[model samples]
Target chain A: MSQILRREAIYALTGLVTVLMLLEYFFWPTAQPWAETIRTWAIIVFNISLGLGAIRLLMQQSMNVQKRRENWQYSAMLLSLFVVMLLTGFAGYFATGLQTSNGIYNWLFINIYTPLGATLYPITGFYIFSAAYRAFRARNVDAALMLIAGCFVMLKNAPVGEAIWIGFATIGNWFQFTGQIPGMRTFSIVGALGLIAYGFRALMGKERGFYAGGE
Target chain B: MWDVIGLWIGWLLMLMIYSYPLYKENPAFRTAEHMFIGVTLAISIITNFSNVMRMCVTPLMQGNILMIVPLVLGLMIFSMLIPEYQWVSRYPIGLLVGTGFGLGIRGTIKPNLQDAIIDTITAPTSGGAMAWFNFLYVAVGLICSIMYFMLTFEHKGPLQGPTRIGRLFIMVGLGGYFGNTVLFRFTMLTGRAQFFLQVLKLIPM
Candidate 1:
């Protein structure tokens, strides 16, 4: 297809999808069976995407290891654990008559993955502290506003300040409303709008990087 | 004994996984990241498929073959795997996008519009100074935030005042985000610490 034709095609398809979704949301069939069918299809599609993503992740890590990258060992460890987890999970599932309770999969997930995932974010506190010490300098207007807001919220959330000041909760609520809530909402709206636009572009085929050629 | 050993080993492994990044990137962390992603993806896929086959496809195949419309739609998604046949992928994409948008619009109205707005507006008239202040904040916050998205006109006119206030509200929001970030980081540290102490045998694991 020619460039202009491709762009037009992309726009048309994206618009169609958007309209259909809107229709489905508000005015689609109310029948339980049809709704369930859509839900099932959605689940299947989501799973296929998940499988594809895993394959891609493995490929990326293997490439890193082959190139002898700085963090290749992490990749190796990750792959090993992955295989171990998958085997245990599937085997345990079948062994226990498809029951998730009291299985190797559930055990590993609860004991290992959940803890590690939750912990990963927390462990970054050292970095955050270090980063804040260096970067939280109130040298400018915006930075100063940020510093003030951060300090207030931190104080309110922490148990120490509430003990010292009875009004900390009130102050925290005030700060949250006047400062954080509005700002985040606007930013989120902007983000959502951008995503919608890009989504439209992709649907229309105007965004084609995922495809083989630039076309 | 074996279960205990495995648990401890897992904990040690978790610590090493986080710690290795500090010293330098190594095969251990890479292996862990890849393995986690891969296994998580595989398990999720298998489970989801089993569920789908059981609930949707099996019943359809057994009784009403015409009920396999969605199954065909599901297959259309695989068109993405092909080069020239890729346009077929759009069929499924269209269905998904349309359905998601339609659902979101209907689902979002109550939470986003009526309850949040009406509740804020109807806060008690009689209260202590702090209570009155909070009520006002909620009312103002909702309005200012909504205004932040206005695009038709420049915020330079009467909106200049409210929009400036809106900007301040946004900064406050960002500050909350920063605080959350700090908390999140500490949580990560605690995870690593737990791994070291309980699993790695650095303390007990």
Candidate 2:
């Protein structure tokens, strides 16, 4: 019974939903509202799945603290923050606690969350710049062209390049946008074809790598 | 006063993150990283949980019978926590995957496939001889780039010339993307530097 649910039933449900959507998209215009509703249900389902990661993190951190693993203090700190954040978050769940300027949740988000998130890209920029030396090496014709293009872009951005020659910025703009449009268009078409192919495979039960196990 | 406090806190956090490269691995960075993780995960879980309450449970309570299906499906997902009933989660997963792919294909079909082809073939020709030349050039480039993706037929003999042209287009496209990425990183670094300078009173807002 369980085997049937996991294998055949799962695939059947997927195919039905996919067919419903595709039909709404192409054939059954009247099914638009139904399709949208189904899409909403799917989003809700995916969001619920999001909690699984937090559950896993809580479990792992709890174990680390219990076992007194190396740097277990850090694990304890994480667990505390996780629990505290959850409490603060839920405190604001039913009220104006999350968004109101006077609320603790909003305060924590601004001071902690916003700063932490914003720092990510700027910090990562350092490592990328360090790695850029190796990456920009002209090992082949493709590498050389890419390097030249990167240089032009950088030149266009910097005032020094324009001071040397005004055409540097113009050439860079042409290379970055006009030169890449046709190729980008072609890529988009190919990517869409691939997506349609994958959707077909799912409909045919050929794409079973997702949720095909546990049977 | 609150804004000043937030600014100081943000400046300190930014300093902690930026110090990582200078010190290799440090306590400050690890603390920040772990705290970020915990807070981020908490935020995500809480947001999703609230969404569930708003979208599913509340609707079911208010007499929307259809909400029960997703509610049940979502509850079943937690069964994966138990070993024996882990198989039960596959139903919701299947539904999610199906909906995702269906949406993906549906979304891409018109914009990426249909309109893309239409745009390429019906290129605007109002900008004189240069416009005509560009249109023809793009048409050829697009055809060649597409031919590069056709792997079933070998790119030898008759297919060699177009195949090479396709490769060049691919490289140029890749180069443009690479350049844009580097420029983005540069902007980000500069922004961080500016923040530091502002905090030090070396620059004005």
Candidate 3:
């Protein structure tokens, strides 16, 4: 196609697709059959994506093993665990007869995955403490204020602050409830708008990054 | 039984990789990093597709032609993948943006502006000093945060005080961010450790 023709086709396609999506969003049919059909296609694509992920995991593990990398052992372990999980999950589905018992997949997910996932958040305490020690310097007026506010909030988050200064607890609560929360909300709203705009530009084929020849 | 032993060994191996980052950048660490990124991306794709098919695609396919809207919009996202046909992504992007803006405006107008304004105006003093401090916090925090965004003009005689207050609020905000980062990092460390501990002992199970 000619340059102008390509551009026109792209724009027209994007515009048409956009209209369809907007229409669908506003006037979603209240019928169950339509919902089910949509659900099937979504699952098929998602499953294909999952299979791709498993392949990626296997590839990385193989690479690590070949290179004899130090953490190669870990990579191997990850692949093994993933395979086991995948197998057990599939097996359990097929052998639905033994579904009542503590199936292999269920046990592993609850005991292993659940704890590991939950710990991800709580484990940040060390990094936070170390980072604070390194970066909490009051190099400027703004930095100083940040340090003070951060300290206050940190203290207030825990019971120790209340023990040290009764006012700290209340102050922390007020800062979060009044200041921090509202500020973050505004930032999120503005950030989301920017994200949507960028997403649109990308989808319209306006995004040069997606092009094989980088613009 | 074999799986159990393998899981324990895997946990140990993962912990070792996690520790490599604290020491120095090494092949082991890099390998672990690559593996993590690859696995996570893959899983996310799978889960999302599973959910979309279950919730969206299947419904439309089974005589629910109306459900074609989001699917087509979503597929339009792939126009970005087609190099020559990439401009098709714009349609979905536009739809996403329009809906996002609508939802955001609807959600934000009342809570962010209206409620905040009302709270600022209705200062309370029922709890003595504590209440006074809270009232001041609301007043100052609102004004200062807003003032910080005022870049249209330079701060001069009258604007100096508000500008200074804005700077102060900003500092406070930065501090909060620092604290959060520190907390997050520590959490990562704890997570690695917990993984090791859980594998070493069956108690966590």
Q: Identify the candidate with maximal lDDT.
A: 2
Cα error of candidate 1 at position A202, Å:
11
Chain A TM-scores for all candidates read 0.70, 0.89, 0.70
Model 1: residues >4 Å from true position, as ranges? A1-33, A58-119, A167-170, A176-179, A184-215, B64-67, B128-145, B155-159, B191-205
Query: After superposition on all CA atoms, how large is the RMSD of candidate 1?
Result: 5.0
Give the per-residue lDDT digits (tens) of candidate 1, residues B76-122.
66666676766666555655654554455555556555555566677
CAPRI-style class, candidate 2: medium
Model 2, residue A89: distance off in Å is 1.9
Q: After aligning candidate 3 to the native by TM-score, how far in Å is the CA of B107 from where it should be?
A: 2.2
**Model 3, span A52-159: residue lDDT tens:** 334545767789888998767766767766666655654654465232132666665544554344433443464556666897788987777777777777777667
Across A1-215, the per-residue lDDT of candidate 1 in tens digits comes to 65434345544644565555555556664454555556566655554444545566777877877898976776766667677766776675567546254366676676666555554555457668878999987887767887888877777777776888957755665565545765665564555555556555665556654432334
DockQ of each: 0.36, 0.67, 0.21
DockQ of 2: 0.67
Which segments of model 2 are wrong by more than 4 Å? A95-102, A157-163, A212-215, B1-3
Flag the better candidate by TM-score, 1 or 2.
2
Q: List the residue pairs that clash in candidate 2.
A: none
